[model samples]
Structures are given as structure tokens and as C-alpha cells.
Target: MNQYVIRPVRGDEWAKVKELRIVALKDPAASVAFLESVAEAEGRSDAFWQARAEGASHGRAARQFVAEGPGGEWAGSVTVLVEESGTTDIFDQHIERAQGHLVGVFVRPEQRGTGLTEGLFQAALEWCWSLEEPALERVRLFVHGENARAAAFYRRFGFEATGNVVPVPADPSAKELEYAFPRP
Candidate 1:
């Protein structure tokens, strides 16, 4: 929207970062895709939020971007974490390749259908491609198998199903579908 600006999150906007995260956790679709609960996020301390924002905004291995409205209210956000080759992940798997992991994607309900998400992804993927040596080979995201809307959107954006399925650690009965876009 013309009234909004999409850019890298600022270090001092931790409070707003917390607020947007709480709101995102409350979205109906969150239960299937996000691991955090609204109640849990609401319980975090201010210091935790500050640390989180600061790390995400400046961390060399990750980044967080936000869409701020004309009034400086956070409308949505997305974060990307770099997963390098040979590193072992919490999932007990070794990353045999270098890639960017897209996470914490959210767009407020009122901002949906206004092209905010596409713009957000553009900014994120562009940044990922801009990285230096061991340059990103791909950008990947895991979507709940039942999240058809999200899967459709990712498909439209040129990401393809990698046919790799990862079970949710918290809920073994659920599976996450891996999708990836190869760097151009």
C-alpha cells in the first residue's frame, strides 16, 4: 500500500515487533503453520522482545523485515535464517547444502490481498540472493500439508515441492511439506 513502507526492521522497534508477533499468533491459520501460541507470546518479557528484535535485525546469519504503516504501526513481518552446508540442525539433520530458510511469515488480515505478501517475499528473496560467498543456492520453506492456500501462493511464486516431508516435532501426526525456489 502507498501508505506503508516495507524495509528491514529497525533495532529500536522491538515493542512493535512483539505486538505484531502476538497478533500473528492469533491469526486462525497460525495453528497449522506456526509453533508459538498467542498465550505464550503474550507472556514473554520486554527484555526478551528487545533481544529478539536486535538479534534478528543485525544477525549475520538471519534477518527480519517489517511492513510499517503510515502511522508507523507494524502491519506484517517475515524472517529468514541462513542454514549453511555441513551444519547440524535441531531436527537432527546435517545441512548438506547452503540455503535460506524462510520463517515467521505473516500479513495482517486487513493487509492481505493488497500485494503486501508478494512484496515481502520479493524483499526477502532479494536479500537472500544478495549474500556473499557460499552464496545462497536456494530459498526454502516448510508449509503445513493442509495449508493449501499458502502452498498455492508459493507455487505461483515459482517454488516447487521438493517431495521432502518433515514431521512436526511437537506433533508427529502432522507433516510439513518442503518447498524450494532455486536461485536464478
Candidate 2:
């Protein structure tokens, strides 16, 4: 219901990607919603952002989608990364199959509940499914156990818990729940 266009981020738009991510990290839920802290992200060099943006821009292994308002404001974003079977995930767990890992999800505070998330997800899913050659069987995401808000949103989008929980990298004593959507 919001007047925004959903599209993929360009390789040259690394600055926008970095800017949006900074905003996301400042959010109240950032501590649980994301694995990186503002300090951690800020410490990275421009080369890191350039590589990230380039990968999402044209690489088959990953893609980032954004909801851009007419006035050039970025309302929201979601990224999908292809995971090959037999590889170790960020959590150091064995990946079971070729899948898409959805991460970096965020929406500007004012843009929440505007259907922007749905738009971003639809784009992310479409890109994931469009990948050929080691086809994806499911799409997955990680949600902090205490972050019921994000978990509920993922559930509404048809992702189900696989009963697998992993320790949070930032706080090993804590946990993050895994949810996934089987490809249709």
C-alpha cells in the first residue's frame, strides 16, 4: 500500500546500502535482529562495502532487494544468499541443501506495516527461485529467540521452524532460531 518501487541494489550503490544498514543497526531490535554491531560495521573499509554491493549487484551467489520511495528514500531491504550443500554456514553448522539464506532484512521505522516488507520478500524470493544449476529447495532465515516480532513476521510469510537452534555468534550463551520456507 506504500508508494515505493521494489528493486535490486546496483553495484555502484554501495553507499546507499551502507547508509541503510547503519540505520538498521541503530534500531532498537538491532541487538537481536542482526549479528553485526554498529561498531563492527563501521570499522570496515570502503573496499568491504564495494565488494558487498558488487556481489549483491550482479553475483549469482547473492542478491539484495530494496524498496525505494519516489523521493529516493530507501524504505526497506532484504537479501538472499545462495548456500551450497556441504558448506559450513555462518553458525558453523553443515548446510543440508542448496538453499537461499535470507538476511539483512530491515525497514525504516516509519515504513513499518506499509506492506514494504512483503514487497521486499517477494523480490528476494523471486530472485532465489530464479537461480538455475544447483537449484534451491528452500529459503531460510535466522531470528533471535527473544525477538518474537521478527519471528511472527516470518511465520506470517509462511516460514516454519525446523526445530533447529544455533548459538548467537555475538553472544554464545544466547540462541537464534531458524525458520525456512520450502520452495513451491
Candidate 3:
């Protein structure tokens, strides 16, 4: 049997989702690895989290997958948002093709190097490719340039840099590097 049960989070699991997100934000690398600050996340209303959980739980446009450990704890999570062709993404960049953008990736420090990330990415990509209405051309993720560990992991997992660099909104001196994996 698989060591972890990898699955999409149900709407009823909003509390757990919220708790995990808080833990993720407290990680030492959260400054470079995540766009939102811990305070921002904490300030969000419970209603907001509930709605987010419901939306991601039922939509093709977005999904949040979690890796549930043997003890029913969440070890990691990855959220994928589908960007449609001809629309601007959250960053205001024009997207030329429908694709999946991986975000909110977090794995517990203890879970790192245990293949939990691979399991999360596998589930995320599989869901992306399974969509038929707006077939995704590729899956992409941005890594903070300063995050060498994450960048190396993405490369080892088959993502190639697309030569695109965007300045981090929060830190003008830093940049986020784009990496992509084409649909197979």
C-alpha cells in the first residue's frame, strides 16, 4: 500500500486545510517560497477559507491536493490553477495557451526527501492532463531564484526553465524563474 493517501481535499476539511497552510507559512523558507506572509494568511477570515476549500474541491479550474500521512496528518499539499488561453494571469501576464500553474506547494520538513513531493506533483499533473474541455498544453511553476533547493528539485522532476523571469512583487530585487513540463 502507498505510504500516503494522495487526494483532493474535501470541502469539509477546511479546518485541516487552514491549519496546514498556517504551518506552511511558518516554515523558514516561506519568505522566498510563498507570496503571502504569515500574517496575511492568518488575517484571512474563516469564511474565506471555507469558500476557498469548497471552490477548489469542486472545480476543474482549480484544485488543491493534499498528501495525508498514515496518522491522518497532512504532510504536504500542491494547488493547481488552470489559466485559460487569451486571459491574463494573476500577474497580468497574457497567457497564450491553456495551462496549469502549480502553486502553494509545501511539504513538512520531516516529509522532505520521502518522495512526498513527487507524489504531490504526480497527482497535480495527472489532474491537469485529464481535463478535456480546455486541454492544458503544459504545467508550469515559478521558483524564487534564491530558492536553490526548490529549483533543483523541480529540475530533477523533469521541469525545464522556460527562460522567463519575473520580478517578485514583494521583493523588487529578487526574481521568480519560470519552469514548465509539457503535457505528454
Candidate 4:
């Protein structure tokens, strides 16, 4: 049997969503792997999380998938944001094509290296390619240059560095490398 149930998060699971994000922010590599801090996430009101959950749960613009263990524990999560062509991204950068941007990726420490992370990516990428109206051309993700482990994983997962780099907002000295996976 499959070790985990991988599916999009439900709209009503806001509390669990908040809890998992808080946990992710506390991870040892959070400073390099994530853009948000625990303080920033915790300071947000419950209403904000509710809205986020609802939006991701049912929208064509975004989707959040979680891998749950048989014991009902969340093993990891990945969120994909669809960016339409001719629009700017969250960083105010111009997007040349309709595509999926993978973000908010997190897997529990114990779940790492057990193929759980691969499962999460597969689910997210599958969803991205399944969109038809705009017909996604590719899926991309940004990895902090300092985060070597994540960068390696993306490379192994068939995402190639696109020669794009963006300055990390909190620390201008650091950069995030852009990697892309063309639609199959």
C-alpha cells in the first residue's frame, strides 16, 4: 500500500494548515528555505489563515496539497500558484507565460529522504499540467542559493536552473535561484 495519502487540503482545515506552517517555519533550514518567519506567520490573525485555506482549497489560481500518513499526521505539503501570462508575479517580476510556481514546500524531518517529498512534488506537478484553459507551459520554483539540499533535490526531480536569480527580500546579499520543469 502507499505509505501516505496525498491530496489537496480541504477548505475547513484552516487550523491544521496554520499549525503545519508554524512547524515549517521552525525547521532548522527555515532561514534559507522559507521566505516567512515563525513570528510573521504567528502574528497573522485566524481570519487570514481561514481565507488562505479557502482560497487554496478551491481556486484555479492556487492549490495546496498535503501528504498524510496512515496515523493521520501530515507528512509534508506543497502549494502551487498559477501565474497567467502577461501578469507580474508576487515579486513584481513579469511572467512570460502561464505557468505554475511551486512554493511553501515542507516535509517533516522524519519524512525526509523516504520518497515522501517526491510524492508531494508529483501531485503538485500533475495538477499544474492538468490545467487546460491556459495550458501551463512549465512549472518553476525558487530555491535559496544557501539551501544546497533543496537545490539538489530540484535538480534530481528534473527541474533545471533557468539562469534566473532574484534577491532575497529579507537579505539582499542572498539570492534565490529559479528552476524550471517543462510540461510533459
Off by over 4 Å in 4: none
Runs off by more than 4 Å, candidate 1:
none
**For all the candidates, what are their Cα RMSDs to the real structure?**
1.2, 0.9, 1.1, 1.0
Candidate 3, residues 146-179, lDDT tens digits: the string is 9999999999999999999998988878999999
What tens-digit string does per-residue lDDT give for candidate 2 at 1-184? 4679999999999899999999999999899999999998888899999999999988788899999989988888999988999898898889889999999999998989989998999999988888888889999999999999999999998999989999998798889999999999
Model 1, range 1-184, lDDT digits (tens) per residue?
7787889887788888899999899899998869789888999999999988888887568889888888878888999889999997545668988899899999999999888888889889999999988899999999998899999989998899999898887798998898999999
Over the stretch 32-112, how does candidate 4's per-residue lDDT look in tens digits? Answer: 999999999999999999998998998689999999989988878999999999999977899999999999999999889
Q: Evaluate all candidate structures by whole-model CA lDDT and list the values in order.
A: 0.88, 0.92, 0.93, 0.93
Predicted structure 3, TM vs. truth: 0.97
- Enumerate residue pairs that collide in model 2: none
Instruction: Locate the minimum summed-lDDT window of 10 residues in model 2.
Output: 1-10
Query: What's the CA error at residue 160 for candidate 4, in Å?
Result: 0.1
